[model samples]
Target chain A: MGALPELSVDIGGLKIKNPVIAASGTFGYGDELAPFYDPSLLGAIIVKGLSLRPMPGNPPPRIVETPCGLLNAIGLANIGIEAFVGEKLPSLATIKAPIITNIYGHTIEDYAEMARRIEGVKGIAAVEVNISCPNVEQGGMAFGRDPDSAARVADRVVENTTKPVIVKLTPNVTDIGLIAKAVEAAGAQSISVTNTFLGMAVDVATRRPKLANMVGGLSGPAIKPMALYLVHEVVKAVRIPVIGLGGIMDYHDALEFLLVGARAIQVGTANLVNPKAAIEIVNGLTDFCLREKIKDINEIIGALETKGEDHEKKGDRKDKSKANF
Target chain B: MDKSRYPMVEEVVSIGFNREIGKDTFLMGFPCVALTSRAKPGQFLMIQVDRQAKDPLLRRPFSIHGVLDSNRLMILYKVVGKGTALLSALREGDTISAIGPLGNGFTLPGPGERALLVAGGMGIAPLFFLTQVLTRAQNHSVKMFLGFPTSQDVVLIDQLKGLGVDLSLTTEDGSLGIKGLVTDLWDQTLSQESTQKPVTYACGPASMLKEIAQKAIARNLRCYVCLEGYMGCGLGICQGCAAKAAGSKDKPYYYVCQDGPVFSAEMIDWEVM
Candidate 1:
């Protein structure tokens, strides 16, 4: 009977209608899912990572399914910056949601050049620096593994583009918190915690690695819990907003990240599982808020009740739940 | 390429029937009017075997086997892995999610042209559907050569015969028609044919298809092949199913999910594939 819950969220300075974002690579260049649903319904859309030149990606047998997970070595195959801006951006710009361009490079200069090319592009609202692609041989996860290199990639992108810079971190690191702090200190406005975890599978009969790249990134429900812990760690380490993503298949998973203080959440492999996943999460979040009688979705952000909390507050929460239901 | 002909639908439809036709092979049909009405012969479906389980995280791709009553879509699949094993366990009335008429289908033979369908093992899934379409056309003649490992692996013998096509069967064990591969029949069949405009459509193992592609190219015959690969998203998004492009300088790979589950044999680098 009251107004709908407020779902809009601000990822640093970039504002979106909700907190469910379509992760890069999973949601092609924003056109692939048009048949399933209107992409503008999501908080934002991150197109596949683009480089200075078109990438052919890895050879066939690039993906294999594991227990509750998917191992993919797509090798960052994309249509390049020029093709995207010229071919995809015009149509994508028509959508109401903010379009964030995910960029990666093989070198520091390649990263800076990609940032410069899309700097004044009219449709692009933000730039997500992918310092964390595990499948690439050169600059991808190499830059993300070291704190100083991660900061430099962020600093260069921030310098090249006026758009808000979001440094996406790789989970295949010793201390993710240190990398988060370094990128935040380097002037990145926001950070998306956790790209796919490095993993691989093998065919026992053939004794051959499942992926052509030998090792690929593991994603899906198998990585959700670990991703949540990493997101929580990054949130505690950085002052900038954190976008949580790993194995976010539903709204419950999205809420886990938000409770840990992630500003938004990206639906990656889940999109491959179900193209309507992000939109479904958006609907689920609204239903959750309405059921709980929460006025704004942000009220639950970082509202996790840890151990040793006041007994009186815990009692009040129980009493409120009993009365609301 | 009129997009309207191939309308992609993502729906959760209930299974109409699931029957085992041969060893480790099952023919399952679901009543999806949206898919059955528009699905072409060589096109396929991405079926989520178990909607509630996550171990088999991704959907399994199946070629459109046939249509029943103009509303039911059927899939002929073998239990080669976990996904198909789970699909085989699914019974009538159970529900599953599927996305289809996903990729391009076979290009139908024109009037006065002869249709030659070559299927090896489970490759018969799509080619069988093509045979059904080809036989229905007034002026076209359909000749099918199907090869399986043994007699027990062969399926749809009566049904295929009911269609009244010139069907030849071959089994490696010599338990069915011939003791040799299906390509052995190619020389005899092609030499006996009087039609100069015979288009070849094949689906099966890469090695088998490569041999057929080579023979077709040598004879200057028009050939199209239906390809299969492990796919993440049946839509072109994941880029997981990359097939080497033939002699393409600018683009090195063709996404099997989008470009062609069905392609002209000449378009693929047969040696690498």
Candidate 2:
């Protein structure tokens, strides 16, 4: 009741400062956005997806535009796991908040190798296994689409690393809940819902695809509704904590996911549009909870229940009448 | 990294509505920009266009076309994608976000130095400002070779002429000037001025830049080429604008956002380009 309690939330065993994590590929390593925004303000940072070896990523035209969204096929162009530990990790240790590394690989071996390397790095609070990279021919969307593949990939990573594993799920799948359950069953500490949507943009003039890879993963505001639906469904299906992200541009949008049962949220495409998005969300959440007289932000996490409602609960909910047939 | 040095757009002043400069080019003007960093020739601004636009959510990077410094700045961009297309429809007083004086600017030679300015299509945007700088210096002998698909694509020709530089025109179909890419004219020009060590400056498509770099290297001339890549933050954080470069001692892959959008021809890892 006093100042919205603390904004702190626990993911795995790691206690994040807040519920706002800079979504993968948006914040880059902590140092990139350091000039524009204060890095210590966020709960955690999920760096760009890293693989076993360096990836040049896709050819040019790797990005295209859609309504209120973007499609990118960067193919996880990173300095590889070795450089991240050797060069990037040391820089991360300086930041005050926990750093969550997002790992992506081409094969099970690739994931295992990266997991082993990152497990020992200091300041890496947890690891988010990205099984939904569609640009790569193998290991990415291939593992994420099927429950067994997703479980096996998650299991291999959890086996190799002592660090907490939060398997990121892809919305492109038919059953996101099934994938979340599989990931949790495979020993994933938490589940991060929704990577990017498999979408394409055409030049219309040349009658050719906008991206060099022909099709790219779509993110940003356009995918918000779908991401929220997936997060709601996953939180209901899984016992483990769920980190929701997709077109989370403002605090209210993030609150929607929290009310629907997301333990925390990641700001992916929004970081690209506004560098100050993550900071604003953190401040806004604190302000909202304070104004509403709600003490733990966690109190709202997954508060939605379908059980037979009491009369007092019905009176508290104004929208319940709108739902009345 | 100087925190205070970063240039943030003070305000989005001018919204250019459907102001198409060329068939593929669009113009976005900002009446006010925070001049935190001094912009020189070849430097650029990472323009976040239509933050409110739903599709094409990312910002588009553009070379600093010209900055008046009174209370506003103008960016000459081509509508190559959704970002710029949305920018083209902006209004005069509407605000647009921009981060700038980004990437390294073009390196000019000493006074009275002879230099060849080569540009293709919209690549000419950055070079136009470079021309203004060079002509204002009046120390360098400047000659410009501009190439286009056809005569119609020859934008900024009259503008370049007004700058009072030795300008030559080329189009593929021989509609306006010479035929073929800008390098073709450079090849012939280099043959005549073979004796003088002319500093080469160019901005164009990757293919065009590669060919120009090859020709410059073959002639053993010092050249700086403006390279374009997909950008995220425009401020070096995204690492999305990364390009490989041979380092002096330790680091090899240099970030285009930090190290350069303009690099010495020999320093580039040509294979990647």
Number of clashes found in candidate 1: 0
Q: How accurate locally is residue B265 in candidate 2, as Cα lDDT from 0 to 100?
A: 90
Off by over 4 Å in 1: A309-325, B1-6, B192-195
lDDT of 2 at A91: 71
True contacts kept of 2: 0.43
Best by DockQ: 1
What is candidate 2's lDDT per residue for A247-317, written digit by digit as tens? 89998889889989889999987887678889989988887777766688998787776689897887767
Error of 2 at A144 (Å): 2.7
Candidate 2: deviation at residue A250, Å?
A: 1.7
Looking at model 2, give its docking quality level: acceptable
Docking quality (DockQ) for each candidate = 0.65, 0.37
- For B71-177, candidate 1 gives per-residue lDDT tens digits of 99899999988888888998999998999988999999888788889999999999878878878775797889999999999999899998888889999999989
Compared with the true structure, what per-residue lDDT tens digits does model 1 show for residues A1-325? 6789999988988989999999999999987788877888999999999999999999888999999999999999998999999998997766888999999999999989999999989989999999999999999999999999999999999999999999999999989999999999999999998899999898899999989899999999999999999999998898889999999988888988999899899999999988788899999899889988888888988887788869898899879866743
Worst 10 residues of 1 chain B by lDDT: B1-10
